[model samples]
Target chain A: MSKNIIIASTSTLHGGDYLEYLLPELSVHFEHCKTILFIPFARPGGVSHDEYTVKVSSALAKINIEVKGIHEYENFSKAIKNAEGIFTGGGNTFLLVNQLYENNIMTILAEAIKDGIPYLGTSAGSNICGLTMQTTNDMPIIYPPSFETLGLIPFNLNPHYLDSDTQSKHMGETRETRINEFHSFNNIPVVGLREGSWLVVKGDTITLKGHLTARLFRQNQTPAEIESETDLSFLK
Target chain B: MSKNIIIASTSTLHGGDYLEYLLPELSVHFEHCKTILFIPFARPGGVSHDEYTVKVSSALAKINIEVKGIHEYENFSKAIKNAEGIFTGGGNTFLLVNQLYENNIMTILAEAIKDGIPYLGTSAGSNICGLTMQTTNDMPIIYPPSFETLGLIPFNLNPHYLDSDTQSKHMGETRETRINEFHSFNNIPVVGLREGSWLVVKGDTITLKGHLTARLFRQNQTPAEIESETDLSFLK
Candidate 1:
């Protein structure tokens, strides 16, 4: 019915070669769409993003797609509200939540997607879709002082996944065990997203990408590994 | 009647004296009781003492009173149930919760204290008493993955107090604000405890000390400074 959602590990400028993994997924929905709205207020982790927006725009232009960083625009309100589609890049989730809460952009962002404007969320952007900010393991280097988040998804997300090494002296609970603890105290399912991987939701079709596997742990039950084609709605 | 509850910052020997402000309140409680059972199990962030029982006993005996590290017992079953008064010390709470959950000691501990054992909990020990481990500001370096704590107190505990210095080059949020972020996700009250200070509970009596004022912050509310004689039952 409508080009819906693209949740990713990160946008092109965020370390990985985003174009190689993202372009194919994006073209599926945005085959005819042009003029993408980009938001970068989420990069408040003290990590400088000299030209995250410019870099992405340059990449999109190579594909004959027109892109613009609309941080400052005429009627900034209307630009985001009526955009053909929007792409949100990854950064510190706390910083993103801080702005979302302060600027009252959460509801409006949700509205844009529900209204049929294709929405793409990367890394920290995807985190805001969870129930609370507690699920994030990011350092509090940035603080919104509030955990309020955009609840586009019912579960928590552990982005940029790394497995715990069982052979080495690098001792610590594996990421799988960490997610287990959340469910020990909480009932929500936590999804681990590996780099270059993504969750694509269009209307009701949800697909996993990058051939990366995810693990799901629930209370009193052992963790189970999930592969591509696994339906996440049942988890909801 | 049970003796008063004295939550200390550490279970290591003499660490309790570091909290001189709590001494007066404990002394008053001692005026009415004869034996005090030191709880070292909560030290590991779990239910079983494992190897810490002998550790607590040796330390307390130096104080010229009868002290038994509950770890002396072969099992946690009889060790906790027989105690007339209990004190839980601070350490890595992850270890504590793991042991507690694995051994199913939380239910036993809660039952013993709720029946009037006059339980005292320090830092890690106190954290477990809360609704969840969400109250602790400890680095997730040793995360047990579960934030579910004892929930004995409705509020979270932010130990090792530090103030915000406007001149600080540290770009991240202050410790207080980071703790405030925790409250944003949950309604649990947060108590900022400075060194040498603690909340002493004897029967219905709750006293504060250590010459340092405490801070209490709630969700969507300005944090307020608390002083001695402050009725903190709102947290318990």
Candidate 2:
């Protein structure tokens, strides 16, 4: 079966409500499904799973879609298998990957998504769709058993990608610099997804979405700017 | 033997030459030492170990102290043991920790520093002096065998800590937010050492250095703004 996915850079854009920016796109993307199975393991601000679920639930309700937390189910793998649609909210990528591995649902969810179930991932959630979680900007608060992820896509992602502020005196590595460092150790390509940007993956076609142009970094090559609506299926 | 260490937030400040800001203090930090051993595993910007060593070598030349890379020695542990002073340059924390474990010199180097070998760590280097490298802001680039480090200090260090920019529309987690997420899973205290700030450890006493105030985050406690020269021994 062909895959259907919306991998977004962020759940909430600046000054916007949670999942607000993507609501229009998501409504169409998840039109066929009545509900979305919410994976709240990536708990932003360390919110409890139920609390994070409620936030996503209320947001998706605007489009008349009910949301259920995967944690609410008796068996996580069974939950994913039964899910008609899946939406994983953003938080710490390490925490999300660790929970998925610990619950033995990482592979199950990956298979479910590949089976053509509509899926939406934001920030940390979007990161797991990559070849590895090595390019994540989240803190390694808790170490997962492995850096592996779903591998739904051929490349990795650097979410909420910010350009360097020339005016600022801060010496922290810029998003580009960090991705360059990642290239130093791994050969996987990385997409620097800026806020309000996302990737639309429909089976064999993967296209950049939203207003911003994404930065693409490949090993031994200069990073390129990918405009909206650009097909990125060539990354593999 | 008492510990004599300088753990800094960054190697260089904006518009400053490498090690320019810290040369005065570093001169005193390594006053008794004739030659210092350099650990260039972090390799900022993916520079080679020898290339990184050359940068450090020239920088320390201003202090009239000779420098040597640890990679130059066949017996890595022995080189560390006989070193009068040690300096680990800033770069990718994961790469640094991975290299240390791979070489089996992590414990040896830790012991050497604790035995009164004057040591200096900047950025990724300073991160290893903490209880764990969990608070670092670097990309994971590579998977280290363990997040464990020198544990020379009671708490973890978040080097190059950045304050949230109220004016910017970027949705990335601020340093404080990331550290807060860390607190949810780990109890280790984390010092958010801003660029230009550092910690001076003389035996059991660890004091904040530089002109800027550092932020301290403890589990379940409100983040505090620490003043310069303030002793942080209470974190233990």
Candidate 3:
């Protein structure tokens, strides 16, 4: 079966309601599903899993879809296998990956997604769709057993990607600089997704979504700007 | 033996020459030493160790302190043991910690500093002085064997820390939010050091240096603004 997924840069856009920017797309993507298995491990603002799930539940309810927290299930593996749809919300990537490993659901979740349950991943959730979480901007509050992820896509992602402000006095490494440094140690490609951008994947086809142009960084090559609607399946 | 250390937030300030802002203090810090050993593993911008060493050499030359790259020595253990002073330049924290562990020098480096070896750590370098590199802002370009660092100080340092830009519309987690999430999983105190600020450790006393105030985050406590010259030794 062909996989269907919406890997978004963020759940909520600036000054927007939760999942506001992507509600149109999500409604269509999850049209046939009546429920979503919400993985709330990446708890934004460090909210509890139940609290995070409630936030997601309220948002998806706009499309008449019910949301259930994965933590509510007695057997996480069985939950992933039986879910009609899946939506993993954004939070800290390190904590998310750590919890996934702790629950031993990293691999199982990947299998279920590949088996083609409609999936939606925002921020930290989208980060795990990559080969590794090495390019994440989240603070390393907790260490996961491994840097490995689902490999749902060929490249890694730097979400909420920002261009360097030449006018700023801050000395922190810019998003571009951080990705360049990653190239120094590893050869994986990285997609720098701006706030409203996302990747829509269908089986072997992947295309950039939203209006913003994404920055693509490949090992030993200059970063290029990718326009919206550009097919990125070749990266695999 | 008493430890003498300078753990700074950055190596260079905006539009300033490298190490220019700290030269006056560094001169006094290394007054008794003529040659200093440099650890260039955190290769900022992916510069080679030799290249990074040259930059440090140029900066310290103003202080009459000759710099030698640690990579030059065949016996890293012996070289660190006999060094007059040690200076670890800033770059990628993950890379720095990985290299430290790869060389089996993480513990030795800590012992040397505790034994009264004057040490200077800027940015990624300063991060290692904490209990772990968990509070760093750098990308996880490589996986280190452990997040453990020198534990030279009682708490962690979040280098190049910036306050939330209330005017900006970007949705990335502010420095404060990231630190707050860290508090949820970890109990270690984190000092958010602005670009110009630093911490001065003399024996068991750790004081905030520079004119800027720092933000301190402790578990279950409200984040507080710390004034310059505030003695933070009690955090130990």
Candidate 4:
């Protein structure tokens, strides 16, 4: 079956709008596609259902894309196999991983990807694309025996990268140190995606989308900046 | 190297105070033990260094147990090998797993636990005592490339069991359902520890501490109540 997929970080339904980051490509991808299957159940933690899914579906409706939420589907395998385009909205990665692992949907998703589903991942949803879910700053507030991921993108993705606010009262590892920690163990490039930004992956090619720049972290080299046209050899 | 251990559900610093729930036998276990080590860094998310570690020492000092906070020891090997008795504080399970996996400390800790060091885990720290980090309410907020743990105590540990408060205001998965999901994949019994509670593991014996009750979620059966004197066969 033909498949194109888009997985978002946390949908703006709660905090901010990721629609602008998601919709343009999602709409363009769905433009020629016959049907779009919207996965609202990807909001795994259950907190995300009322917060984001409703907002995303309404926004996509305005853009003329017929988006269908996946939670209403009776058969999960059919929902996954029948979709011409699959868009996974993000909420909580643990919850997402838990549901996928429980329902045995991760294997199906990986198969669809290998079969060239034209997948797109953003934020938490984007996180599952990497070799492992090892770089996100989300709290392991929930646990799923394994940190298994889709392993499609073959890179560690850091979404919503923010500078340490010296004025803030939050006390935890800073973003820079956390990324450094990722580098301490992983040789793969860690992509820091700012708000409204994304990594667009086509056949054997990956390019940046939106107006935000990305910070690349690797071992033994100073972190470098990647402009829009930068070669994403890591993803390729 | 005499070893002392404190396996608590919540530390005195995390505003949960496990000492009040301390079994009288535990106090005797550490009576002759000088050089008490406080492991506050195990909890990577919620509790801060200042908030969790310093208080552990100060509280232990009140009872004449010479305490030392191990937060400054960045080296995992030295931290585990030379430690007198290691106490793991609670925060988030994902954060602890990532650090243990990234630094390769699980094997070191497993060895330490085997040497009869009094190992204590509370909430997030306690969750790390399982075979896998399967039963937790923390988000997969931080992903370590893998999900291996200390394997100190057999059976999964679920800290802080709570009922769903109508889900209209709460944002995360309910504790019961999350544990239920965990049982669907794992056949292991899950020990639900409330605040001010703990499980003291000595050799093959598992003793329940704290005034509150605990729920045990087993495979294919309804969760059963674990009374004060009930011996947990999973600890065997």
Candidate 5:
């Protein structure tokens, strides 16, 4: 079986409903699976696990998919092992990675994904699909055990990546400057997935999908803007 | 001896020369000291140690103070111990804390500050004067061995803190939201120091300085705006 994944920059774009923009793709992506094991550890807006899980359930119900939060299961590792399809929602990346390690389910999830169970990740979820969580834009609210993350993709992912507004006078480091600083200490490539963009991964092939282009950062090279439908397998 | 420290929100304000706005305060802060040891480990924008040191040197020269980069010394710990004053410049907080741990100089520097060596810190540097680097706004470009920092101040500091710009359409989390999330996981109070604002620590008294009002976030309490000259020693 080939791995099938949708790594999205965000769960919802500005002025869009929760997970509403990706319902069509998700419907087809999880067509063969009836139920999705939802990992709500990210918990955006400081929502409880149960509440976040219900949000996911409501969104997926439109496509006739049943959803269950991993927290609802007796064993999280077992839940991952038994899941036919999985979806990890967006929130704080540090919190998500910390819980994954604390619950000791990282290995199980990686193994299940390697075995080709369909997977969907958005924002913080998409960030964990990379080599490490070092490139995340989220605040360091908590100290995770490690910055290491699932290496489903050869490189790291920078979600909700926005270009600098030239007209603005914000003195904080721009997204490009931050990524370049990451490259100074890390050699891994980073794909800056702008809002409304995602990557579709099937087997050994990965294609960029969405209306916008992504910015790619390589060590010592100028960042390139990749258009929609571009084959990104070469990055692997 | 009483501790004399300046925890500034930024090294440079918008449209200002490096450390230009704070030069008058810094000159008085280091009145009796002829030379100050500089820690440039935070290396903003991927600048080299010597290069960053040079930038600091040029900025301090306006106040007629000599600056020495910590990297130039043979014994980093001993150099910090013998320094009359210490200054940690702003940059990536993760890199700053990582180097402080790797060099095993966190304790030495913390002790020096406690014993009244006259310390000055801006941005990432100021964030480390707190209990941990959890409130920093920098991206996680690297993972430090620990989030623990010098507990010179009893609470955490969020430097370069900006309030929500309602006119903008950006969908990212606000600084207050991030700090609230931090409080959800940890009970420490956070001081959101806006650019141009700083805290002047003399002995056990910490007074909010500069023109702007600082935002204070305590666990389970509404955030309050503190005016200039407001004594924050109670938070200790």
Candidate 6:
């Protein structure tokens, strides 16, 4: 249970610098690492691998850490196994999971994470840490081999989770309604991680962090708000 | 190419009754039918098959058109072939498409639509009429056998499409950004059917119906707002 991970709801907050809010925390998370492998498969706005990697590099530059895109490697599995640390940026979950499966590195990355390599994930990146990517907010731009994921956590993570706007006139399904529908067919617990909030996984303990509270959804129960500093290890 | 269909952005408007706005049109579209087969695979808010079917039945009762759930039939393919008309209710795109492929009836339904059987699709249902469900906004509650849909139209559809609220502080990916990501990998055109707007397909001519404008998105081209009654045959 030596899972050292940071599952964030978003990579960049609105009006904030890229990864600026989490730099201090990440600085400590990756203290022992020199370079971290970045998986840019989620392709934020369909950015190219190199371009997305550059974004990550720029964000991590302030922390004095180097970043490399996995797509640049000739052997992806070797890259995962040999990486000092790993950082998966967010975009479309389907595309990210598709590339992970297509390159046959899903299991390798999962093993690496389980082996206690520091990991940082935001949005779609954090989604794969759950049992499956079934709770993602991204469009299904690509079909993954399966909905299965790393299963680093027992429950599913719904990143970029937002509460229904009471004044909105939109008829589209709200985030809560969508998750309830997921519960109709699934028995897994779901953590609705709000933007700026994240889960800090250290060994067998997972503590909710940042400035906001998270919504926890379970089958046949009213969703409850979990405050910061809450230990969610019980969900495991 | 006598694809007689009504692809709606939503089954119900923000404050309108279920299918109330579309009843007159549906009355004409399903004029020759006594009973229309209803596929309730997209269970909105985790509604039961029977419960969702009842909602559709109630909505169509005014038109004197009886509605039957496809799940009630012993053979789904036979049910599709025997249907005088078909209506796929919107819920979850992934769930609906999953059931379609799982029951091995995607081809059957596609054939029925191609043969010009009167058809009605709202939201997730309308999403399946496109080249793929890559542009869907529904959470991926389940994984379908393929993202390939019925291909009833030349382009994809984004139902319940909305514009970004300028005053809102939400940082989630906007509909435009999601579609742009889809275009980065796919060259297909996408129609963002806003609430209250629908497409009336007759033969090779697809006319925008209802009172609102539908936004059309093509790769490398600026997205344009198409007024009601505009013939979108050029997209084909």
- CAPRI quality level assigned to candidate 6 from its DockQ score: high
Cα lDDT tens digits, model 3, A26-126, are 88999998888999999887899999988888898998999999999999999999999999989999999999999999999999999999999999999
Q: What is the lDDT of residue B218 in candidate 3?
A: 95
- Candidates by TM-score, descending order: 3, 2, 5, 6, 4, 1
**Which pairs of residues have clashing backbones in candidate 6?**
none
Number of backbone clashes in candidate 6: 0
Q: For model 4 chain A, where is the 10-residue window of minimal lDDT?
A: A1-10
User: Per-residue alpha-carbon lDDT of model 4 for B1-236, expressed as tens digits?
Assistant: 33234456555423334454453544576665677666665444344666767667765665667666666777767867887677776665666777777767778887887788777666677778877676664544455666657666667777766545572322223567666655544577778776566676666667776676888777777877777655564542
Q: RMSD of candidate 1 to the true fold?
A: 11.0
Q: Rank the candidates by DockQ, best first.
A: 3, 2, 6, 5, 4, 1
Q: State the TM-score of the second chain for every model.
A: 0.78, 0.99, 0.99, 0.83, 0.98, 0.98
- How is the predicted docking of candidate 5 categorized under the CAPRI scheme? medium
Off by over 4 Å in 3: none
lDDT of each: 0.62, 0.93, 0.94, 0.63, 0.92, 0.93
Candidate 1 lDDT, B155-200, residue by residue in tens: 5676555567676432234566566655545577777776556766
Task: Judging by lDDT, tell me the better candidate of 1 and 3.
Answer: 3
Displacement of the residue A210 alpha carbon in candidate 6, Å:
1.0
Off by over 4 Å in 1: A1-3, A11-18, A44-50, A74-76, A171-173, B1-236
Q: How do the residues B1-236 of candidate 3 rate in per-residue lDDT, one tens digit apiece?
A: 79999999999999899999999999999999999999999999999999999999999999899999999999999999999999999999999999999999999999999999999999999999999999999998998999999999999999999989999999999989999999898999999999999999999999999999999999999999999999999894
Q: Report the number of the highest-lDDT candidate.
A: 3
| DockQ of all predictions against the true structure, Cα-based | 0.05, 0.87, 0.90, 0.10, 0.71, 0.84
Model 6: fraction of native contacts: 0.84
Judged by DockQ cut-offs, is candidate 4 incorrect, acceptable, medium or high?
Answer: incorrect
Docking class of 1: incorrect
B56-92, model 5: which lDDT tens digit per residue?
9999999999999999999999999999999999889
B133 Cα displacement, candidate 6 (Å): 1.2
